[model samples]
Target: MAEQLLDVIVRKRELQGDGVVVLDLTRADGAALPLFDAGAHVDIHIAPGLVRQYSLCSDPADASVYRLGVLKDPASRGGSAGVHAHLLEGRQVQISAPRNLFPLAEGATRSILLGGGIGITPMIAMAYALEQRGDAFELHYCGRSRNHSAFLAELGSAPFASKVVTHFDDEHGRLDLAAVLGQGRARVHMYTCGPAGFMDWVIDGARQQGYAEDHIHKEYFQAEVDASGEGFEVVAARSGKTVQVAEGQSILQALTAVGIDIPISCEQGVCGSCLCDVLEGEPDHRDVYLTDDEKAGNDQILVCCSRAKSKKLVLDI
Candidate 1:
């Protein structure tokens, strides 16, 4: 992963609103960056062992630079704060190739994009792809206020501006979810990214309105996980080794302590980089990356932020 990282230079930085900042990065050697699809994200190596994932919000057709919209989180674990403080114009940085976890559904006749607050970043790129395909789509952006929303001017000036509807809590009151998603029809798909609570409301609304689970897509930046639990034994079947996972420790930490390495990014369980297969016991799934149906399968686990429910488990390793 280290050898695959691309060195980039920050071309510009723009303040979107109160706590939001947008960054434009280009190849340090004046070459075109790798082409990425809409809803793709790159892992930025902010500092040693400090990697964070951010979605690309720029137009996919243009390979000149990759744009990212970041919110300065007051409760950041150093990702957002570091970017706002040190990721300045002309600064060189390293980032991973783009990876997409929230891809658009193929052959959908209608698409609905719901972006809340800083979540509008990915939706902007998605809008570009949808418009280019000449597909019917609508973007509904909800924010606390106009001053707090990032990329308002850009969204308003976009060619698809007529298809965008914005709702501000301070101005337009609440966005009626029921009205926006009245009935889920065939060939209609929905995508959402934002706070967990807001996402839950939209997802529940969509489900109640007859939308299939596969037709609804979402991406979570972080999840509230309780990784602490009783100690257990993890058997690495391939390596022929066993490690005791102590209480208050994750499976990933325990394995790494014994020199078993698993590539990881976004330790909060959002990136799914450390996903591993389980051959034996049931896992207490705490990550939001896996859907409820996937959790029910119980064949795999996200070792980074998930613990075992069984006392002893066998890993495919």
Candidate 2:
């Protein structure tokens, strides 16, 4: 990977409750940074040993700086806590160019945004984009408590504030899945980001409500495992090489270890960037990106985090 040394000075920091820290970064090099669309995220080289992905929370029209919110997850693998504890004002860090996988679609008449806790990060940007285009939309933000919610003030100031509903588990109880889905009117396009369970719940509800698969969009904050087992061998037809993937490792990680370059985003298997042809063998479809018919055709698989079901599988790398 090509690495660049850029000094991203921390311009300001705000605590948005629930152990989440919002950091605003600006370039110290006095050069205009690359422009990014709403729902874009950047990879920050937190320290020599840590790299973390954070969504861009600022308006895309402003190229002066980038805003990111970090939640100090106690159960985290250390990345979140590191940002909260170590990243401070006046500190400089290196950041990758912004990348976006959750972009707003064109020609949608109306929008419905569902966000859970920190998952609101990207959805917030999408809401802004839709509002800028004068699109009608409603935002449903669910969290454990008001104190646990981030960007409450900003969300309340949005043009669609009256359309924004906040559901607190502590007060309002759990979100009424039925009510949210039943409120649908007009041709509404749905966008959601949250934990696996939350996403699954909304998706299932939408399906039951007769929402077309294309109309409901989602981004997973975590991977969902409906199945699990030991790994096997995968043959890349184009590279003409085979690699043995062991248990506990994803096929994408295994292939990359063997020096094969594949473009990938959201290694959690939500994004379809790492999709490749499955020329032969039964694939244990575990990714959310492909549909049932697509998987049944045995045409492609997401190598980033998917494993093989058969003892040996062939791929058109």
TM-score of every prediction relative to native: 0.94, 0.83
Instruction: Report the lDDT tens digits of candidate 1 across residue range 84-103.
Output: 99899999999989999999
Give the candidate number with the greatest TM-score.
Answer: 1
Task: Encode model 2's per-residue lDDT on 189-290: one tens digit a residue.
Answer: 788888788888888888887778778887765675433579799998899889988888788878889899887655666657688988888888888777
Worst 10 residues of 1 by lDDT: 220-229
Local distance difference test values of all predictions, in order: 0.91, 0.80
Candidate 1 residues lying further than 4 Å off, grouped into runs, are: 1-3, 239-241
Q: What is the C-alpha RMSD of each candidate to the true structure, in Å?
A: 1.7, 3.2
Q: List pairs with backbone clashes in candidate 1.
A: none
